[model samples]
Target: MAGMPTPHVSPGLYEVFLAVARAGSFTAAARVLGYTQSAVSRQIQALEDETGAALFERLPRGVRLSEAGRVLLPHAEAVRDRLARARAELAALRTLDGGLLRLGAFSSAGAALVPRAQAVFRARHPGVVVTRVEGPSVKHLGLVAAGEEDLAVVSPAADRPAPEGVTLHHLLDEPMLVALDRGHPYAGRRDVRLAELADEEWIVGNERLEDTLFRAAPAAGPRPRTGLMAQDWIAKLGAVAAGLGVTLVPALAASSVRPDVALVTIHPDDVPYRGIFAATPPAPTVAATAFLGLLRETAQELTPATGR
Candidate 1:
């Protein structure tokens, strides 16, 4: 006896079988599939040859399903339904209709950049769920590199390079601002030089001068005395409000500071602007790309054409 037909069938063969079964005739299935009647018959023949079972019985008027065809109907329908659902899910991801976008950012960016971008993203793609994590820029960068975060808003350190497996898109260079008491003489000035504030006590977030925001300032002049250390923004601003000392604030965060504190732009030559970026993996998700575009728009709105 001849060897049995190898059990091999393509999705297209099942599709033709389904069409012919529904239409009850090769000619009708051809019309539904936009293929010639001979082509439909050839597909059905191939499917039967592969399955080693006759799937249809010819009739004087049309055709009827064989016992094997009836047995296979539901399985073919299931495969067809599964493929359709898979296509829909892929489409949703492309269109941002559904998916999750994981985000990370440093403290200051949470003040405006990240929040504004997140608001716009949520408004546009309500189906996409966005979750955010806040911490230091280095931590966010590491999370992004490790694939825990889809994207991150970070002010990259000048001396340190981004971790491997990460790509950085520069958003802006934001100038540092001095957060002083309302009663401070420099409060009303358009800008102030660091040399003028050398005698003043500085409120810093880190105990080490190199780790604080002031590290960005040129090292030529005498370092301001950092007498107070307050890791929390509330404590730092509270100290500044009471005229205890002044702390450096990123320009991105200037809008969210307390009204009792004054924000004075530091001279460009004194403390250089910090470089802000959106960090992502080599292949970012569609939602991450959309959120990054929104971040760029918000960054532009916050900075003047002349540059901050």
Candidate 2:
């Protein structure tokens, strides 16, 4: 039997190899792992030499994992995942008073919900640091899935399913409203029906989200002509206030609106309400769990006041 090659691969080398394989370029892997390209190359070479097998084949544009690398990739990934979980657990063992909370939120929740909950949580845990980021629900979910965020607040539209690998904590059912300039024809209406508004111009934030909810409306009709498309909720709200078109707003969003806009509830028989949920990473730290509990309590308090 051939003697086993001398093992030169350390845990650090395994990590670098995994990053290089995932990124497909030494430069990209270096950037992701905070290492220099030369260092990444050295680690891969060391691993290959120790194993007596070619781990990667250099290409003109980048690199491709060789047969040996393909065989090792899954095991390496499992090792990294276990190490990450161990590190998280170790960090959680530190003093609870000084831990950090990494949170993400969709636009409306960031504007109307997170601030209030943060204020209350900080008052109780003054030593903790709270970091927040705002983005669309899908983006927030992506961050949580990638381990960039501990928890995220999202509003799942009626037809959109909750994302995988996260535990959703239902907080409230926020009704959708039609936002328009105060002087618009539908502004003074107590409720707006989807059928009556089908012919009017609309300002939709995200087409996929709008379609997911609007298609399920009881009064679903021809899609409105999208006069302006906005990626940001604030911009969409501003467009609506400027009479660009009528746009849908959640109850939480309505509460944060400026005085120039009017919010009319969509008929219950029309669009169904959206649900506000707190989504946490598959495995969360103790501090994150505590903050989520506080968030749930705060959401309950804010729900009744919103008449949801």
Candidate 3:
């Protein structure tokens, strides 16, 4: 009689039992496992000793699991499946062919870079799963630092760079573009200056986001009035298209601009650019590294170094 007990039970012992149970004979189990019949018998005996239960009943013709064996059968099968899964996951993690990539991104990057990276990643590694969270870059930085996320596409404030234990891979500098209704007086121009739009109302996703822009443009004098505050890129762009006000659109988000709105570059000195980075643990997993490379490629496509 075997029972769960004092010393550790080797997974091998249960494996042997499962083989014997499946084959219904020690000799058959030995043949399948490439072990001698005596070896199979000894391993099963050891399992029975450890568990204090008879895992099989012997008849003149063959063998079958006893009452105790039936109880342990499912446990053995589960352990076998678990080990198989563990091996597969480890292999995936090593090769970047499978596993999950937990990614965090700020609003603009989520609107473009992260999705582009995810699509390319899935094409190359279909078995890998990607989960994403959207928030301010500062929040994403904390998630990466805490190991809650594998990595993030962040636009950390210049003075507040990567946190302790995390590293930043520079992606690109996204110059801010002004989103204005096509009907605005300066809409026909390819570029505009911050000083020109100084008195114009500003549209923003939220007050908090507006603060960042306002802080940077204090040199322009009074903070631009907030005529309308929309909660998402689409809403903000829509409002601008309706002649509500203007909002800043990152270069990363330029492609998603509304058809009726113009994304006009600002004068170089007044143009505020946010640095994009791939923040990760110093030694990221294969999946994270692979995805990071794809993100860089996507960033290049969005903001080419050629400066075109």
> lDDT by residue for model 1 over 171-253, one digit each (tens)?
98888788889999998998988888888888877523235445655575447676788888899999999999887777887
TM-score of each: 0.81, 0.63, 0.81
Highest lDDT: which candidate? 1
Higher-scoring candidate on lDDT, 1 or 3? 1
Candidate 1 yields a Cα-based lDDT of 0.86
* CA RMSD of each candidate after superposition: 4.0, 15.6, 3.6
Candidate of highest TM-score: 1
Instruction: Give each model's whole-structure lDDT.
Output: 0.86, 0.80, 0.82
Candidate 3's C-alpha runs over 4 A off are 1-4, 19-42, 54-74, 204-209, 220-222, 227-235, 305-308
lDDT of 2 by residue, 1-308 (tens): 77985744589988899899989999999999999999999989988888789999999999999999999999999988999987875665465666678899987787668888888878877777889987778888778877888888987554567677777888888777878799988878878888888777888765465775567763465487776789877798888878878887778866778789988888877766778888887788777787788888877878766632
lDDT of 2: 0.80
Give candidate 2 misplaced runs (Cα > 4 Å).
1-95, 157-164
User: What is candidate 3's lDDT per residue for 135-201, written digit by digit as tens?
Assistant: 8888888888888899999888876645887899999988777888988899878688778888888
Measured by C-alpha RMSD in angstroms, how accurate is candidate 3?
Answer: 3.6
Minimum summed lDDT over a 10-residue window in model 3 is located at 299-308
